[model samples]
Target: MKLIVNAIPFAGLETGITRYVRCLYQALGAELGVQVGYLGYHGLQPTMPQAADPDLWSRQTKRFWGLPQPLIAAINATQRLRLERLLRAGCRSVQPRIYHETDLIPPPRLPLPRVYTIHDLSLVNHRHLHPKERLWLFDLFFERRIRQVDHVITVSEFVRREIIRDLGLEPRRVTAIHEAPSARFFPRPAAEVGAMRRRMELPEDYILFVGTQEPRKNLPLLIRALALVKQPTALVLAGWSGWGDQAWRQLLEPLRLEQRVYTTGYVDEETLADLYSGARVTVYPSLYEGFGLPVLEAMACGSPVIAARAASLPEVAGDAAWLVDPQDPRDLAEALQGLLADPERRRDFAEAGKKRAARFSWQRCARETLRVFERVAARKQARRS
Candidate 1:
């Protein structure tokens, strides 16, 4: 079967969705006796498995979503139209057994069996957390065309339910395939963890939060919670910048967490694994998530995790993690302080987390996803027959 994934996300920024598309495709491409192709570049030329990582993408992704006010909206419109035309033209020529879009937007009027991955309803349901440009684009392109998608893949059952509720799609049209921690995230040897921590110049003991600095992450609440914790540990954040730099500054300034908080910009996968393995406890206080990859990553690294109980987080974390209310800073602080006060409890959670993380794998995600594509392809074939 010729399975072509619209891997254009890998050709752009190294965001969570990009990582999702790349990792799933990498696993799928490795299968024998199947011709797996990628549409990473504008030409829709077959994607190289080696180029799945965004580091290898030739062009530095132009950050347009969060820009200064003076830039003309016309330029953004022009760019969107041009990209749509180029992608549509390039993709239409490569007729495959099935075409899968990793992101929300589907290809324009391509008469092929198509599958779309819906990460979350955050854009559709919680538009206030995002910028106007993003909301505008999604409203224009994604909302209408998404219904035309032949099938849908969601990261969690919560998202699958949300899709049925929000999109009014038939339940059978969507499948929930759990995303996994990458191969790089796992229990690292103590020596290697120490060496990497030293190389990164990280504090010996600190709370860890792995996510972009954004409003959706509820970082300000976490920051306030950290301030209230009487424990002597620092807070280490490992992620790229999103849209809340000013908000972050205001929160940190008033709290005066200059000595207690450390914010490291985008670290490589190896470093991220090390940071996860090194933390006293990893925290994920996001208000919502489609799947909450970092929570699983921390678990895979054998790190004790404390995540929010909202949305898909509890679904992902399951019984293995300490769940906290994301909205209440007081509740988050109590949980952090309580966990830190008991090392024995942290150790117990660590062991449980590792066991839980073992249940999910990229290979499994690929297999399930491939099954969905093949199911639809067979239907399309039977219709023609």
Candidate 2:
């Protein structure tokens, strides 16, 4: 079946959504060949800004938000208009059987069946957690625009339920297609892991937390919990800094954990795999997530995971990782201590996690997603008849 997708996300930084689109299309292309088409701006793949240097991180944050609010809004409007024009022209040429909106923003009304992928309703559900501009955009456009689509696809069942309950979408109109860790995330050899650890200047034994350092990630709680752990293990924050208050650093000084924590800026997937393989245990105590990918990634890389028992994390981690209350530092600390103290338990968890991670694959996601597209297209054709 012929398909067209919104390529707007490719114009920005490499985020979870960007990765989702890239992986899904790669798998889809392998099966469908030239049936897939992309519309909108396609710039050079955006790289994550390195944050190993504090000053560089600060400058990048300032450069992003330094623009006047009114100017930023105008730019956003112009970009959207250009994207819509591109979509209109591309649709005429490609004559696609289905249109998939990978980004939340909907395209102009199209004759063909349209499917939208809503990663989460965080802007509506957790407004306090997002930036002001994001809230304004969601309030003004997203809720209304989302209703115009024929079908909604979510990254997790929890998010699907949220979209159904909160947005009042019909259960039959929405589907949940789980995402998978890339093939690159696998058990790395000990020698490679050792060399990577040395090259990155990471501690001999460290607890790994992979993701952008933002308030939503609950890094402060992880830092506090680290202080409480009995072992003198180091904590490594592997991803770059995202937009949010840098309160996690403030806590480190007061808690006397300044030296115990290390930030590796942003590393590539290969380095991430090695880091995960070398980690004593990977922890992702985020406040909420539509789908907790790092938990699966860590498990796939032969590391035991400890994730929050909130939102979709339990669903993602399944029975493999230790689930803990995200808000309670003491509870998370106890779990960390218990897990670190037990070698046999960690090994068992690693095996169980690998098995759990294996159940999800990009090929499977593409197939399931394709079924939705076909169903939507068939129904449209039936209605036309």
Candidate 3:
């Protein structure tokens, strides 16, 4: 019943992986009490049950110990030997039945059952969208390391299919466990939403897009679509400015959407809830996704969504969102125009979205994940018996 999750990713940036690890661990820890622990850069920390709020744990740790991505990679490379030693020490102390690898790095070769969660095959699928350094590490370790795991987990069925086809993993060996939005994202009161809007200097009614501004997010297509939309409603770009900002900016330049587009760089989850609640319609036209989190998050917050019919988005959005071709600006623009004009449709979608989002919860995700771990561990034990 004892489990140790490699939490070294928490020492790095607060990406989607970090959220997944934190949330899953919190729920698992709550369920299992002291039976679960986390293996960080230092060693083993059997302090799971103590984490009342996963976000609190992340805030305390990330601020105190977070490192830049490149530096974290360099440190991980240099500390592999040390890491193995720590792993051995942890194994001896905790005697864990399972080791969960949250990040893509291969689990240290050990007797314990291994569970590796592959968020996406973006590196393999879209090399141009990723950095050279990342691709280099991926090429060196991903294929070799992936084979060492006892079981694989993916965030979505689309990714599960990709892993099965590309890596040739057995279908039963890989499971797709969907992620859920934090409890923080829900319908905020109109008064609170108005306050947040004023604080961020956002328009009263705006279309919201939440994600890092990267090429893979398909920001250019969204920007082009925004220009094409005749509605005077503004577009709020809420997230960190990832790479490829120039290309998106170039597309935005000629459109003269400087006044129409509001860039609120990197808001917190609380702010995000307000943004989502206040939004007329939330648009996510990403080219690909392992799981389109914002689509669900917005849905949870009572925002009708229009997501791209690409990758796992349609699966995540289901019939709750207005699915449009990511490549076609006209399609996106028309969806926007239609959604903006129809209040009743928006209300219906909002209710349906809430109902759909209610189907997912971190507790559910944790329980299903635990079932996977139990099966893997029991299989290993059976082999020994």
Candidate 4:
């Protein structure tokens, strides 16, 4: 069956969703009997396949700024019209049986069956974290798209439950597909890790946290926990700063841990892999997550992980790492201290994590997604018949 994968989100710089779409498409593209076409505003670009080393496709594209508010609104409206025209063109040329909306935005009402992936329902549940104007627009446009789609897919069971409870969707109408870490996240040798450290100028020993600096990530609490640890390990945060730097600084100030914390802002895949490899331990104490990709990535890199027990974290970690209550900074601090002091425990966790990481793969995710596509197409055919 001909399938059109929506790729609008790729127009900007890389994010978690970008990696998810790129990995799944490349994995599915390698298979036989499935013709795939990427329908994106950015046009075609190089993508990484499963056979190649994950780092091979890790380069970042040029970044672009959005137009002014009113102008951006008009431009997006025009793009939506153009996308509709493009969909019509595809329907006539390739006659696709299914249109998968990889990003949350639904495709312009189309004749073909529609499938959407709902990464998280944070916008609805944790609306306070987002800018009011953006949240308003998201609720207006994306919420409608979620309800109108033929089928929905979520990355975690946590998100699936939220969608059903908040949006009143039927459980069967949504499928939960867990995301896997890139193959490059596997354990790296000491020499390789050292080379990456030199290239990125990362400290020789540190604790790591990788993700956007949103309040939902619970960075302030992690900072507090870091201060409580008696170890001399530096805290290195890797990701672009969102919201503002004030909250991060304010939390670190009172604890006198300002000098111990470092922010790398953003780094490429090679550097990121090295950061994961060389770190003493990685901690992810987010308040909520649809899926915790970093927990698995750190596990794959042979680093002991300490993640929050709330939301989908335990489902992802699966006894491989120390699970802590994110709401309690004291508990998080105690877990961090315990893991830091015990080398045998760290090694034990690392070995178990590698084994657990082995269970997930992008190829498996793609195959499950393809089954959903087939089901969506069959339902459409039944209605037509």
* Residue-by-residue lDDT tens digits, candidate 2, 108-223: 58888999998877777888888776666556567667778899899999999999999998999999999999888999999999999889888889999999887789998999
What candidate 4 gets wrong by more than 4 Å, as runs, is: 42-82
Clashing pairs in 1: none
Candidates 1 and 3: which is better by lDDT? 3
lDDT of 3 by residue, 27-144 (tens): 8878755277777667887763232244454465345335566765565466665766788788888789998888756676887999999898888888998755456656766777
Residue lDDT tens for model 1, 210-265 = 88777899888888999899987999988766665457667777888878888887
**Which candidate comes out best when scored by TM-score?**
2
Worst 10 residues of 3 by lDDT: 48-57
List candidate 2 segments past 4 Å from native: 42-62
- Which residue pairs of candidate 4 clash? 239-265
lDDT value, candidate 1, whole model: 0.81
In candidate 2, list every pair of residues with a backbone clash: none
Instruction: Note the Cα lDDT for every prediction shown.
Output: 0.81, 0.84, 0.84, 0.79
For model 4 the TM-score comes to 0.90
Clashing pairs in 3: none
Can you write out model 4's per-residue Cα lDDT over 68-132, one digit (the tens) per residue?
A: 55554555566766776776676667778998887655565788888988888778887777655
